[model samples]
Target chain A: MAELTYREALNRALDEEMARDPKVFLMGEEVGEYDGAYKVSKGLLGKYGARRVRDTPISELGFTGLGVGAALAGLRPVVEWMTHNFALLALDQVVNNAAKMRQMSGGQLKVPIVFRGPNGPAEFLAAQHSQALASYWAHVPGLKVVAPATPADAYGLLKSAIRDDNPVVVLESEMMYAWKGEVPEEEFLVPLGKARLAREGRDLSLVTFSKPIKAVMEAAELLRAKGIEADVVDLRSIRPLDEESLYASVRKTGRCVVVDESWPVASVGSHVAWLVSHNCFDLLDAPVELVSGEDVPMPYNHSLELAAQPSADKILGAARRVLYREDI
Target chain B: MAKTAKNGRNTLPPREILFPLLETMQLIRAFEEKSGQMYGLRKIGGFCHLYTGQEAVATGAISVLDLSRDYVLTAYRDHGHALACGMEPAPLMAELFGKLTGSSRGKGGSMHFFSAEKHLLGGNGIVGAQIPIATGVALAQAYEDSGGATLCFFGDGAFHQGALHESFNLAKIWNLPIVYIVENNQWGMGTSWKKVSAQSDFVATAAAYSMKGLVCDGMDVLNVRDVVGEAVEEARKGNPVFVEARTYRYKGHSMSDPQKYRSRDEVDEYRRRDPIVFLRSRMEEAGLIGEEDWEAIVQRTEGLVEEAVRFAETSPEPSLGELYADILA
Candidate 1:
């Protein structure tokens, strides 16, 4: 079990998937010769050649649409946007075509495509670059939205996403790329819509995904020291949301706190909270508490940005408020 | 320039195919007229754009292709394209009625007709959205070694969309098997072509992508057939071809359109050279069919359309449970 950073795990997944299937390839801005804007696709162009590992002009709409075409034509294309913020330029292809093609074609055409890149708040990137829109994709019906928190999960989920016969959005966090964890060397794929119980407990269930999972785990440990055992659930996939696991954990704990980096109104946290109230209402001991990012746009200042997002302290405070029978 | 129409008889297609083209044109006209009446009675909701004067563009373009192997995709004004591609009139009418028997299982309405078995990708609602998708289908055919070409149909309004340019460049650079047909109708909604575009010539736009472009009189079915036939052959040879079919729409843009932009005389001017009249007159002069035979064909088309409406009226609306279906794998 060697320790690999989240960036390295994603690179290894792409390398292995490409080596396994000739039809599998990578395409995007700076993905080929430039070794990826985040250095996640380094050395791939040298190994795979330009045809298999193509670098494209800085036309997001053009390249993304090309990738969709390539995928429809029998190639499994791994398309990377420089950042999720840049995805707005290609929203027509991603939302209008990629998501709706399979159903619109009456299950005749399968868009086996993957749109991956770093998502969520990156420090000093200001409002344009530093925003979390995972919930925006999760709100759609046909597309699969995934945000894996750990390095191993990043590798496993990406492999699964490439193999999926439907469109999948793999959102990675830019700030979490260097964070390291143990990853197996052999081939493995984690299924979509499955949640992982990162840290099991009984007092309060802390549910989150992507980068916030780490913060939730940290807060869970801090709460454990204060004699409050919190169960930490990492939601790997958000679209085919693992409601079964979420409800089971909520039913067992009788209290829940959802943490998300997106805003509170119409957010993933609100949806999860709604699901809990709708499906697991009888199991609730107190009202479900939610710790979400502030509704305001992300500020450029370091302190302001940090305060805008959900943190371990904020989650811990939310958990205590639920435990203390306070309005949450 | 090289005198490629050597077999003038072949260039003028046999009476057998010509009669079929006439039938298709009449069917489109009658179908759109009936659909217009339906839309007035509060039957079909949402956007109801008609392709009344553009029937020759679809009928002529689809005539030269092998429907079994080739794929066809088009923009929102797609009823003619769908019928020309061999979709049964019943399912199409049912689709407009929001019945489960429709091509899209009643979910797509008129703008999203899809038939996988016949290789009709979709009647996409968004402008210029199918350009890249059709190019992708062509790329897929090339990847699978299927020896098929994809025909992408859009309108003059779609040329303004940036995606069309992107699709044109990539299709040319990759040498994908695709024929990009731009039906240059004079209006996009209420805006006229001359008003919106500085250069109204769409064929020159194709040259910017280093693709061969041909412009044909969309009001003449025979001219459109010959041009599209050559373009389809060129596309099959792994060269993407672009053809601009300069047509007009006799009806309003959609059901809700007031058509306050153009005068009634402009509509009558286009109606004078209607494709149906051109085909029938040519057939009568050539002794291909008698006047009585042409009348019978019109009667048969109207009967078929009436039968389709009856089928659609009897068809069931999709259950609410269907909302959860076809949304995932």
Candidate 2:
């Protein structure tokens, strides 16, 4: 096993996939000359050359639709959106074309493409740039959404997403890019639709993924220090969600808290909370608490920005409230 | 005035190709006219946009393709293009009927017809959505160093879309092999193209991408054939182009439209230059056509459309289980 950052893990996956398939290419703004806006595609342009590692104009809708079209013509394209906030410009292509082509074409076209970029709030990006928009995409059928919390998951899930026949959206985070974790050297795949148990406890379940998984883990530690054990489940796949794992954890713990970086209303984590309350109604000892970003747009003020978003402190409070302990 | 193209790549059609070209235009018109009638009878549902007066654009443009290898991508007014590309009318009819035997297994009707073997990509419904995709398809051909090129067809109104400009830029820098054909039929549903666009000169839009831009008489099949042929030959050399075919649609945009946008006189003026009529006259002037040939072509087209209707009527509705199928690989 080799220790790597989430960014390096993703870069390795792109490198490995491109090396394996001649038809696979990467295209996006700054992905080539700039080595990716976030440097996740570092060294790829040098290794793959301009033909395979293409830098695009700041035309997201154009390039994204181009990626979908290339997929129809039998090329596997991994498109970088620079950031998910910028991806809204290509929403018509993503939702209308990439997501609909296969079924709409009656099984004639399979768009084996991956749209990856940093998502969720980082620092004080404010308003448009700080939104966690996974739920909007996850709500759509014919698309797979994955958010990895660890370097290993990033490597595995991204490689799998490139190989997937359907369009897959990999939501990454700028904050989590620098976090390091151990990744296996040998070929490995963290299959889509599976959840990883980050930490195990018995009193309560901490359900989350991506950046919020870190908060949930810290909150679990705080709970453990207080002698209130909590189990942490990182939902690797948002669509084709690991329902069995979520049900089993909630059934065993009898208490749950879903932490999402997005706002509370109709958030991806809120879906998990609803699933637990309905499916494990008899198994519950307390109401399932959802720890999510505040409803308001992220503020520019650093402290208020931090307050607007979910934090380890907030997850800890939700865990405590679910466990019938001190709320603050 | 550079009818030969800025790259000097245009080719004049041989007399032998005219008969087949006319047949293609006739087939497209016959198919569309029948579809319009079927739509009026309430047998066909959903939005049905006819390519009535633009027969020459589809027929003339597709003639330049090596259909076995080259690709065709167009917007929703696609029945004409589908027929010209040689897709069986039965499956296309079945698609409109939403039956199991449809081209898209009834999933895509009127708006989305594709044939992998024929290399017809799809009839995209979203305005100007196919522009970027077609550009990407051209990119794939270029990356593989394949001689294959793509023909991207869109309406004049779609020319105003941002994606089209984006495609032009990508096509230029990448040297992607593509021919962008804009069917300037002059109306975007209820609104005129002039009202919708500040600059109605579509072929001029290509200069921004440094691509070869040309305009052809879209109402004349032979004229469309010669110009698009030139564009196709140039694109095969890894050079993309922009072509504006001055065409018009005789039918309303779709079945639901009242077409209160234009006058009957405007429709009649364009009809006088109907591509099929123009080609037939040219063929007569050249003494290459006979009454028997026209009768045979008519018989063949009517019979095929009739059989297609029968096939669609007999084809079963999709099974209840089919809704869950084709969602994944």
Candidate 3:
């Protein structure tokens, strides 16, 4: 096994995929000479040259369109949005073209494209930049959405995404780029639509993904200190969600708390709560609790931003609520 | 009767080619006329856009394509483009009927006919949405350097979208093998092109992208064939060309359009210079097609349209299972 950061794992995945397939290519702003806005594509320009690793002129819709077009024309493209925030500019191309091309064309075409960039609330980059937009993407039928919280998963899931035949969205976190983890030394692929069991326990089930999973794990540790053993489910892939695993966990635990980075209404956590409530209706001992970000727009102030997002305290409170610990 | 084209472009294809070209235009006209009638009869549902007056636009452009290698993608007024690209009429009509035998297996209705073997991409519904995609297809063409070119057709109303400009800029910089043809049919739904476009002539604006641009009479079939054929050749040499085909739509934008935007006089003015009539007369005056030949072609197109209507009527609707099938694979 080799240790690496989330950014390195992503770079390794792209480099390996580009080397493996001639039909695969990279396109986005600064993916070449500028070495990516976050340096995730650090040396790809020199390694592959401009022919494969291209630098685009800040044209999200244009390049994203080009990516979808190339995919339709039988080329695999990895379209890097500088961030999910900037991706909104190309939302039409993604939502309308990439998502609908396969079904609308009656399966005559396959959009083997990836729209990858940093996502979710990060630090004090309030308002536009701090929004978590994965649920909106998950709402679409033709897309496969995944977010990896560790270096190993970042490598494995991205490698699978580059090879996937459908349009895939990889919602990486800006906050987790420097976070390091052990990845297999050799090639491996974490298949899409599988959820990993981060921690195994018996008292209650903690459900979450991406950046918020960290706080949920900390909350699990706090619960463990109080002699409350809790199982944690990391939903690596948001869409094609591993309902089988979630149902199995909720069935065993009988109580669940979902921690989400996005707001409450129609959020990813709400859907998970809904599914658990509906499918595991007979198995439930208490109503599933959801700890989601504040509904208001992300605040610019540090303290307010801290309060606006889901944290360990919030997750701990929700877990305690589900665990029937009325008195903290 | 004029032997030379209205554009004065000496593009009189041989009798063999011109005969089929005239026949194809007749086919488009008949098919569209039937589609309009069916829309009225409620045989086809959803937003049904008719390609009534722009027959020559697709006929001319597609006539020059190397069908085995070339690619053509267009906007929602797609029945003409699909037929012109050599799609089977039965499947196209069935698609309009939302039948299982349709080109897109009945999933994509009138606005989204697609045929992979014909190299015809789906007729995109979103305005200017296909521009960037065409540019990307050109990028693939360039990467392969395979001498294949892409023809991206959109309407004048689509020119206002930001993606079109971005596509032009990218195509220019990449030197991608693509040809952008704007079918300037005057109206984008209810709004006229002049009401929205900054430049009086869109072709002249190609200078901003440092690309070659030309304007031609869209009503003239031979002219579109000659110009687009030459542009396709230039594109094979890695040059992207911008073309504006000044055409007209005889019908309203969609079946539901009241068409209060324009007058009957304007429609009649354009109809008097109808492209199909123009092509038939030119072929006859040049001794390329006899009166008997014109009658036979029209009768054949009518027969084809009748067969298509029968096929659409007989084909079965998709089973409850098919609605969920194409969403993944």
Q: What lDDT, from 0 to 1, does candidate 3 have?
A: 0.90
Please give the lDDT score at residue A57 for candidate 2: 91
lDDT (tens digit, per residue) of candidate 1 on A77-153: 89999899999888989899888877775566778999999999978988999889888788887799899999999
- The CAPRI class of candidate 1 is medium
Model number with the top lDDT: 3
Which docking band does candidate 3 fall into?
high
Give a tens-digit lDDT track for model 2, residues A1-328.
9999999999999999999999889999999988888899999999989999999999999999999989988999999998999999999999988989888889888889999999999996879888899998998889999999899999999999999988999999999999999999998988999999999889999999889887788778877888878888999999889999999899889999998989888889888899999999999999999988999988889999989877888887777678787743
Q: After superposition, how far is residue B82 of candidate 1 from its true place, in Å?
A: 0.9
Error of 1 at B232 (Å): 3.0
Q: For residues A53-111, what per-residue lDDT tens digits would candidate 3 score against the true structure? A: 99999999899999999998899999999899899999999899999988988888889
Clashing pairs in 2: none
Off by over 4 Å in 2: B1-16
Instruction: For candidate 3, give the lDDT of residue B183.
Output: 98
Segments of candidate 1 deviating more than 4 angstroms:
A19-22, A46-49, A69-75, A106-108, A325-328, B1-11
Task: Tell me the lDDT of model 2 at A307.
Answer: 90
CAPRI rating of model 2: high
